[model samples]
Target: MRLALLSPLPPDPSRLAHHAAQFRRALNLGGIDVLTPLVGQRPLESLEAARAWVAERDWRGVDVVHAELAPGQRTVYWVLQALARLPHGPALTATVHAPPGLLGQPLHAPFAGVYHARWLPRLTRQASAWLAAPFTRHIDRRLARRLAGVLCTSDASATRLARRLGLPRERITVLPQGLPELACPPLPSGPLKLLCLSGPGQALRPLQDLVAALGQLVAQGGDDLPPWQLTLAGATAASCFEPPRHDPLTRLQADPRLKALGDRIAWQLDPDPQDLPALMAAHHLLVLPERPQPWGLGEAEPGPTAPQGACDLALAVGRPLLVAQQSGQAEQVTSGNGATYTVGDHATLLAVLQDLLTDPDRLSDWATQARRQATSRQWTQMSARYVGFFQQAVARSTRAATK
Candidate 1:
């Protein structure tokens, strides 16, 4: 059977795009023909063109027209929705790759009409975000319904999508994000090398708080303790230091906290996304110290969902996690795998670090378990599962059509 995938290739560096590419390769390797039109950077333009592309050939001959829905993938969603309404339309499915926090409790509902008016879009984006949210959801429900299963990357996400989008919980499949085939590096021999991955925007305040907590640890270090190094990536390096201690707002080239900690803090300036897996493997732990949840009350987003990419890489590379309790990223974590600390709680972070550093045995144990988790969710296995899910989706769709 043939599947036509509506998703992006590489160089875009989105989590959804990365997984789409992974599934394509795995399915092809497993003997399924995956066809994708040559859609480049301008996806909306390409999506509009796909109508003609399909009309010229056999769009109906395709078994499944699968699309992954991201903010960037909206145009493709519209196109697929339009296509599903045609006579003898092909079966279509979608993978909801958006984080649950954004989907579950949308801040966009407040900004409903603001999205369309170009000038208004710049003002109250809440209206626009609300307006843009349910693009073809109603149609998607009727067309694909049970047959066109909505794929979610996590169980928590699937649950949220069901509750928020009002879709059937049974119809949503939990297909976690896939990682590139990567080998878990050996455990650290020296100080704990902690890598802090910053979120999409200037979400570094929590990291700064953790650093300050570490500073407090250093100050209280009249007692001997194991040392740790923090390497941050994603956003520009900034200090969350207090006014008297350091500049509060500006990003200093050389943070004094680094000096206070004997220069242990470092950051990556927009590292290439392709290099991330290797970077994740290099570090011993991946920490996403995201802010608290229920975002959009005149503060940084609470990061309602887990830091999926960060958590995925850490698990894939066998590096244990040190995530915030507020993030959904901490969902599957256990005392055996890694630790979760409260956001901005430097003392908790300090205590967790002190315990891990002192007890290397526990640290090593967590890493081992992390690798096992990674092995279970390997791309090869995930792709096989996707193929199964697709077949099921097609049969359901075919049966529904017959009825």
Candidate 2:
């Protein structure tokens, strides 16, 4: 099969891009072509730029065009719709990497026509957001229906996307993200190190409660549990400590209780994507404090529907996960591999941490289980599954055209 993947390539630093490159390599039997929009040396910054770039491409004789659609990539949605409408277009499909619900953000921005537009007035954006709030889901549903088929990384995401998109669950295929073959490092001696990774643009407000719980743990001292250290690191060279006092890094840096932990709680405010493997290896556990109401949003707000790159990387590196309940990442944490805590309950989290840290044997077993699980999710296997999905998409599209 000749497959055209609409996603950025590696060296781009997007987890989606890195995965795409992996998938392409693993699908060696299939002629897979990667297409991306770049502005001179760097990635395109706007939806308009992407659309213009795509318009100039000659997608002739491709068997299928599969795009990776994330929260803000409305351009991909537009492309999917455009290609599907063509008289002799390739089969249209997309890997919806986020909850379709979050894709509505573009419609609420001040300059709604462009993705990541920064020059708009603050008041204008706020007003637009307020006005656009009610119909965001409706827009999201329409955007989702544009594709012939959808792919998701987990069953949790598939279920959520099916509901939000008003499509039958059968229409969505669940394929876990591929894991890189990473060699497990020897478990570090002394203090059990924990790592929390934040995306380049992710704010620290969502982690404030987690920070508070860690502060309480620090204040209690390590009398019952083994010594532990946390390194809150960012995915790229951008500060995650912005927008609120509810920020974890800000509280850690400012509060005396948290500061008492000193270097025990470190912050890697700027780290490149290439640094992730070393960070994962150095830490005993990977922490994901995603809540039901993520980013401090209200209960009615739409949260993420899939685990980020950190979760996959941790599993690949054979590190146990400590994720909160109801998060997509939590789905990866089986009792054999890791543990989960109630979403907003800090006390439960504290207890889970103490239990894990107190028993080194259990942590070791969990790490081993994690590595075993990751081995089964390698891209070489995942690529075969993707090929099946792509063929199915083409067959379905062909049937629809006949009708």
**Best model number under lDDT:** 2
TM-score of each: 0.78, 0.77
RMSD of 2: 5.4
Candidate 2 C-alpha lDDT tens digits along 251-369: 44576655666777888765766777888899899888754323221111121111366788888888899887744577788647898876568789888777776778988898888
Clashing pairs in 2: none
User: What RMSD does each model have against the real structure?
Assistant: 5.9, 5.4
Q: For residues 1-403, could you state the per-residue lDDT of candidate 1 as single tens digits?
A: 7998887767765545566788898888667799876356354444446466456566766888888665545456556756765667767788765544222212223342244333442336554554555753444445444336778776777887777656778888886677656888888677888887663333446656777877887777634877778786663323222111222123433557756766477666467667888888778888877642332322223221226556777787778888887667666576368888887777788888878768888888888888887887788877788888888888878877898
Report how far off residue 168 is in candidate 2 (Å): 0.9
Error of 2 at 339 (Å): 1.1
- For TM-score, the strongest prediction is 1
The residue ranges of model 2 lying beyond 4 angstroms of the native Cα positions read 10-15, 29-60, 71-75, 101-117, 126-146, 198-208, 211-224, 235-247, 291-307, 326-328
In Å, residue 191's CA in model 2 sits off its true spot by 3.4
